[model samples]
Structure formats: C-alpha cells, structure tokens
Target chain A: MKLWKKNIWKNTILIVFGIIILLPFFWMFTTSVSDPLKIFSEKLRFFPEEWRWESYREAVSKVPFFLFMWNSFKIAFLVSLGQIITSFFAGYAFARLKFPMRNLIFYIVLGTLMIPGQVTLIPLYSIMAKFNLINTHWSLIIPGLASPFGIFLMRQYFLVFPTELEDAAKIDGCNVPKFLIHVALPSSKSILATLGVLAFIGSWGNFIGPLVFLTDLDKATVPLGLYRFMGSYSTSWPELMAATAISIIPLIVMYIIAQRYIIEAYSFAGVRK
Target chain B: MGKKKWKKSEVMWGYFLIAPAISIIAIFALVPVGYAIYYSFTDYSLFHPPYFIGLENFKELFADEDFWQVVKNTLFYLIGVPVGLFVALFLASLLNDRTLKLAPLYRSIYFVPVILPMISIGAVWIWIFNVKYGLMNHFLGLLGIKPIPWLTSYEWSKIPVIITGIWQGFGGSTIILLAGMQNIPGEVYEAAKLDGAGGMKMFFRITLPLLSQSIVVVTIMSVIASFQIFDLVMVLTGGGPGRSSASIVQFIYEKAFRSFEMGYASAAAALLFVVIFIVSIVQLKISQRITNY
Candidate 1:
C-alpha cells in the first residue's frame, strides 16, 4: 500500500513536469494551426479555435525555406559523415596501432578536449577569412571534420574490442584498414551511430557557426534563417509558429527514428566520462 | 590493446590514419589557441597590421562596465546549471521507477526539446513570454494574477529566459542520470528494502551516494555547457533590455564583429578559456576527493 502510494506520487510529479516541458512543442503545433486574430482572444484556447493550415503554406512560400533546409541538411550530413570517418580511423589508430609517441599524441588530444571550442573562435574565424572561405559552408564543415570528443568516444569503444579478432584477421591476410572496415566497423555500429546522430543533431542546431562565419542570407541555415524570419514577421505569430513548426518536423521525425541510438550515445557518454 | 610488434607497412598506416585528424585539429583547434593567446595582447582590427598593446585589452576589459555586466549576466545564467541538474535528478528518479511501464514514452516527450534547434525553441518561447497574448500570462490570469512583463522589463526579463533554459536543458541531464541510476546494482536496493528503507530514504541514502560519480560528471558537463549559453539567449532576449543579460560569448561577438575590437575580444576569449579551465580543474579536483570513479 505504501509503495503504491509512493508510485502514485511519483507519477503525478513526472506527468506534470513532462507536460510543462512538452508545452512548447504542443503550443508550437497549436499556434501554427491557429487563426491569426484568435490567438489574442480573451479565452485561453488550449487548442486552435480554427484550424488554419494556410499558415504553413504562407510560411514556406514567403522565404527560401527549402533552400535553408537544404543548406542545413547538407551541413549536418557532411559534418556527421566527416566526423565519423575521420574519428573512426584516428580512434582505431590510437586504440590499436603501434607508433612512435602514441601516448604523447593522445595526451595532446586529451588536453585539447578539455579546452573549450569557444576559446578557438576568433582565431579560427580569422583563419577562415585568410583562406577566403568566410561566407562559404566549408567554414562550418571543416572545423567539425575532426571532433576531439568523437575521436575520444571512438578510441574508448575500440580499446575494448578483443585483440583475438585482430590476430585472427591478421592471420587471414587482412590489412589494418581492411580489418577495420570488415571487422571492427561492424562490431561498433552502435557507438558510431551514436556519434553520427549526435553530430547531426548538433550541426543541425548550430546557430553560432552561421552567425559568425556566413553573412550571406542565401547561405543561411535553418536556425539563422528562422531567426531572420522572426525579425521580418514579428507581428505574424501564426506564420512564425508555422515556420518554426516546419523547420522542426524533419528533426522530430529523425528523433523518432534514431532515438535509440541517442540513448546509446547518452549511456556511452555517461559511462565514458 | 596489445602492443604487439607490427610490420613497416602497418606502422606507416598508423601515422597515415592519424594525419588527417591531427592536421585538421592543428589547423582549427590547436593552432587557434596559440593565435588567440598571442593576438590577445595585440591591437588589430582585421585590416591593419597588429601591434602589441601589452595587457591594455585585458585592463580595459576589466574596467569596462559592459564587460562587467556580461560577467554578471554569465554568473546569473549559471544558476540554471544546478537548478536544471536538480530538476533532472528528480525526473530521473521518477523515470527510474520500475513500476512505470510508460517510461519510454515519457522519456521521448522530455527529450524531444533537447533535440530541436534552439532557434525553433526560442521562437516558441518568445511567444510564450508575450506580455498580453502569451500562454504564461494566460495561465497566470487563471489564478487571478496579472500579467508581468517577461522579456521587456529590467527586473523581470531574465525570469522567463531562465525558465525556458531549464525546460529545454533538464532533459539531457535526466537521460545522463537515468543511465547512472540503471548502473546501480539491484542488490543494494534489495538490502535497503530489507532494512525498511522507504522510497525517499533509499533515494537519498542509497541512490545519491552511489550516483555521486555521475553527478560530478553531469555537474562538470552542465557548468561547461552553461558558460557557452549563446544561441538560446541570442534568440529569446538578445541579451535584452540594456545588454543586462548578455553572455561573455555575446560580449565577444559584439566587440569582435560589431565594434571591430579584435584585440579586446581576443583577450575576452583568452580569459573565457582560462576561466573555463580553472573551473573545470577545480570541479575535477573536488570530484576526485568525493567520488572515486
């Protein structure tokens, strides 16, 4: 009876806070479908008083929404792919290879890991400008290509992989890279997925990269574009919400699909850290 | 990892494998730290040759009221870290309940916001904090409380921003703590239950003591993350009414990009690095004493 009572109390607290956290997502959807004038009514309508779907149409057609989405998709895809491939190779090297000064190199990686990325911002920007890549997508893609954290995650994952497999694969005449591709890669799918999903999620939401490096409106990603959208249509709450909803749909869909990978990633991060 | 001796080809492949990542890190991350340190003492405005100005940038930055306000706002903003962690711990404990069958659904619901772009988050929150037509005010009105300016007033502006941050943030930590909770052996709980330890008692005495390592890790992550609070603040408040809520990063942005004060901004960036380093080291040292993991 006491356990049941405690369970009931726990449920109430969880549900209430869950609703509070979920309110904005619900509100974003509701406001997107609501009538423009009805949003300001005396009655606090939890749902839209009138379902207005044109807000979505207006939101998309008003600006280069798809273009921005494309830019974002490209950046996220490239950044994730780049980070995964490079980190996997480097992680494999650090974990399994025999080389001169391997420990020293790894210590440098660990040191850089502790140094916050913000510390590198100004000089990186100048470097970007020096290379005449300031307004281009390369500025965003290049820096994220070799993630220290991703490398660390991969290294840790690889370090635990059994040596007997490597020894067997070597006896089968497989080269180092070949063994990595054929054996190790398949074995550590979950962590790689985790790293890829994390990088995708991060690159998708990246506002600072676009804000500092790219000034061209057409080159703007979703977050930067949506920010600019807010500036223009500040009065049109429904339209703005519609735009916000549109930008988020793909991510929410991706989340639904890759959420398990995210859980794996979180657990990996927890244990490793 | 066995340190078995390898052939020349394999040894060369080892260096080949690392070259790309190391070179890129050098170009983007490592070299920049050196450049930031060097340029932090120089007066360069992008167009001209940089001349050394010693510690003038740091001295001026220390004396500048705007810089201090940035520091003040950053300190105030860090309040979200602990608050968010507490909320995360509570929610994680709830989710940790074995009897809760709908845990996965609730987990997804809580975590959805963490995955969304901050600008999308900021847009929804801006309207939620709207003085007249906002949902926050609408709920307040239900309780016969009048609407307060959530984003405009000097006194009330950061309130909604902080709440929004806490809402979006706690999910990540909840997931971290949930993982931590799972790693706690069931035998410990079974022993506690035999000793008549109640739910609250178990959480405080058993769970928290075991989960201290995770808590330290989460604390370090949250504090580091809190210092870099940029995108959300930029969208919701733009550091607001009078630059009163501006973050250190935002200060760096304004000084470097807006005002073209490269040297000054680099100094601020250098200080930001040093501050983060010191705080991280302090947390780590403290954590070492408290938790053995």
Candidate 2:
C-alpha cells in the first residue's frame, strides 16, 4: 500500500512536469495553425479555432525558406564529413601511435576546448575577408572542418578498441592507413554516427557563424532566415510560429530517430569531462 | 638499423595522420587568437590600417558605461546556471526512480526544447511572453493577476530570457546528472537505507556527493554557455528597451560588424576570454576538491 502511494505521487509529479515542459511546443504548433488576427484574443485558446494552414504557406513565401534550408544542409553535410575525416585520422594517431611531443600536442588540442569560439571570431573574419571567402559557404565549412571535441570523442572511442585486430591486420601486411580505411573505420560505425549527428546538429542550428559569415539573404541558413523573418514580420505571430515549426521539423525527426545516441553522446561528453 | 628505420617511419606516419587537424587548428584557432591579442592593442577600423595604440581600447572599454552594463547583464544572466542545475538535478532524480514507467517518454518531452534551434525557440518564447494575449499572462490571469511585461520592461526583460535559458538547458544537464546518479553504486544506497537513513538524508549525503563531478561539469558548461548568450537575446529581446539585456557577445557583434571597430571588439572578446578562463579555473579547482573528498 505504501509503495502504491509512492508510485502514484511520483507519476503525478512527472506528468505535471512533463506538461510544463511540453507547453511551449504545444503552443508553437497551435499558434502555427492559429488565425493571425485572433491570436491576441483575451482568452488564449490552447487549440486554434480556425486552422490557418495558409500561415505555413505565407511564412515560406515571405522568405526563401527552402533556399535557407538548402544552405544549412550544404554546410552541415560538409562540416560533418570534414570533421569525421580529420578527427578520425587525428584520433587514430593520438590513440594508436607514438610521436614526438605527442602528449604536449594532445594537451594543446584539448586546451582549444576551453577557448570559446568568440575569441577567434574577429581575426578569423579578417582572414576570411583577406582570402575573399566571406559570404561564401567555405567560410562556414573550412573553420569548422576540425573540432577538438570531435577529435577527443573519436580518440576516446579508439582507445577502447581491441588491439588484437590491429596486430592481426599488421601481420597481414596491412599498413596503418590501409588498416584504418579497411578495418578500423568499418568497425567504428556507432562512434562515426554519434560524431556525425553531433556535428550536423551543431552546424545546422548554428546562428552566429552563418550570421557573421554569410551576409547575403540568398545564402542565409534556416536560423538566419528565421531571424530575418522575425525582424521583418515581428507582428505576424502565426507566420513566425509557422516558420519556426517548419524549421524544427527536420531536427525533431532527427532527434526521434536517433534520440538514444544523441542523449548518450551528450551525457558521455559531459560526464567524462 | 632496420628496426630504427621502422620506428622512424611509424613516427612519421603518426605526424602525417595528425597533420591535417593540427594545421586546421593552428590556422583557424591559434593564429586568429594571436591576431586577436595583437588587434586588441591596435585601433583597426575595417577601412583603415591598424595602428598600435597600446591599452587605448582597453582603457576605453573600462570607462564605457555600456560595457559595464553588459557586464552586469551577463552576471545577472548567470543566475540561470544555478537555477538550471537545481531544476535539472530535481528532474533527473525523479526520472531516476526505477518505479517510474514511461520515464523515457517524459525525458524525451523535456529534451525536446534542447534539440530545437535556439533561434526558432526564441521566436516561440516571444509569443509566450507576449504582453496582452500571451500564455504566460493568460495563466497568471487565471489567478486574477495582471500581466507583467516579460520582455519589454527593463526590469523584466532579462527574466524571460533567463527562464528560456534554464528551460533549454535543463534537459542536457538532467541527462548528465542522471548518468552520474546511475554510476553511484546501489550498495551505497542499500547501506544508507540499512542504517535507517531517511530519503532526504540519503540524497544530500550519498547522492549529491557522488554526483559532484557531473554537477561541477554541468555548472561550468552552463556558465560558459550563459556567458556567450547571443541568439536568445538577439531573437527574444534584441537586447532592447535601451540595451538593458545586451550581452557581451551581442556587444562585440555590434561593435565589430555594425561599427566596424575591430580593435574595440577584439578587446571585448579578449576580456570576455579572461573572465571565462578565470571562472573555469576556479570551478575546476573547486570540483577537484570535491572529487578528492
């Protein structure tokens, strides 16, 4: 009887908390479908009385949403692919091979994690400008091609890999690069997915990078597009909500498909650090 | 001689493998930082040549009222860190209950905010904090209360952003803390229960102490994140009602891009780096002490 009572209390609390956390999301969806003129009605309706499906159309039409999404996708895909390649090679070297100044170099890489990106923002901008890369996708892709966190995660993953497989590969005349490509990478699907998802999520949602680097509206990413929409159409709540809903649909889908890996990756990073 | 050559080749292979990553870091991160340090000591507007004016920008920043206000605003924003930690820890403990069914569902719901883009969510929050017909005011009105200006008022502008920060951050921290809680051995809890310890006592003594490392990590990360807050401020408030909610990052952005004062902006960025470095070092020492205990 006591155990039953405790369970009841626990569940009740959990449900209430869940509702609070979910309220904004519910509001976002409802507002997306809500009548713009009626959104400010004194009695806030949880469900839209008239589903204004046109808001989504209007939101898309008001801005180049698809263009923005394409821009985001392009940057995210390249950055993820670049980060994986660079991090794999670097992680392999740091984990499986001995080199001069190895520890010192590893420490330097780790120390970069502490330095916030803002510290290098101005000078990087200047460099990009000098190279005439500003307003180009290369500005977004090149700087983020390698990340300390990605390398660190990859190194940690590599360290735990069984050495016997590598030794066997070596005995079979498999050189380091060949073994990495044929053996190690094929077996590292899970870590690769984790790293790819993390990098994609990061670059996709990135605001400041695109905001600073890509000044053209045609080249703006989703976040920047959404921000521009809000700026120009501040009073159009329904349109704004609709645009937000559309922008998040892909992320929501990605999260649902790989929720476990995403959550575990984040927690692993946090706890290990 | 053959063995030595093989060892040398292995070393060369290692260097070759790591070369790309190191070069990228050196070019994009290290070189830029070096330039930033140098730029902070010069007066470089985008149009003109950078001339050395040692300490001038720093001197100007020290005397700038707007900069000081941004500093205060940033410090005020950090209140979200402790508040977020507490909320995350509480939710984590609740979800950690083995008796709870659908815990994953509940967790996924809470985590929804974290996965969404901050800029998009910031837009959604703007509506929620809307003065007249917003959900927050509507909820308050149920208890016969008047609506408070959540994002418009100078005094109230920071509150909504802070709440949003906490909300968005709660999930990540909860996951980390929950992982920490899971790592604590069941035997310790069993022993505490065997000694007739109450639930609250066990939590304070056993759970919190064991979870200290995660707590420290979450807090420091939260602090760093909050310090760099720009998206939310830009989207939600635009640091408005006269720069009341402007963060240092926002200030740097405006200075660098809008005013094209690269030197002054670099100075601000460098100072912000110092502040973060100090806080991180202090937190690391504190966490180290706790872990030792």
State which candidate has the highest lDDT. 2
RMSD (Å) of each candidate, 1 decimal: 2.1, 1.9
Against the true two-chain complex, what DockQ does each candidate achieve?
0.74, 0.79
What digit string (tens of lDDT, one per residue) describes model 2 on residues B15-91?
Answer: 99999999999999989989999999999988997899999999999999999999999999999988999999998
**Residue by residue across B1-293, what tens digits does model 1's lDDT show?**
87867668867998999888899888898999998898899997887867999999989999999999888888888888889999999889889978887788888788888888988999999999999999999999989999989898888867776888888878888988899999999999999999999978999998998888788888888888778788878898899898867889999888888888888899998998888889889987877887764
lDDT per prediction? 0.87, 0.91
Per-residue lDDT, model 2, residue A21, is 84
For residues A191-248, write the lDDT of model 1, one tens digit per residue.
8888999999999999988989989889999999999888884448989999998889
Instruction: State which docking tier applies to candidate 2.
Output: medium
Best by DockQ: 2
Q: Report the CAPRI category for model 1.
A: medium
Once superposed on the true structure, which residue ranges of model 1 sit more than 4 Å away at CA?
A1-5, A233-235, B1-7
- Residue pairs with clashing backbones, model 1: none
Per-residue error (Å), model 2, residue A142: 0.6
**For model 2, how does the per-residue alpha-carbon lDDT over A1-273 read when each residue is reduced to its tens digit?**
897798788888878878888889899899989888888789768888777798999888889998999999999999999999999999999998887788899989999898888889999999999999999999999988999998899899889999999999999999998999999999998888889889999999899988899889999999999999888935388888889998998898999998888988989999999
Supply candidate 1's per-residue lDDT for B196: 99
Model 1: DockQ vs. true structure: 0.74
Per-model TM-score of chain A alone?
0.95, 0.97
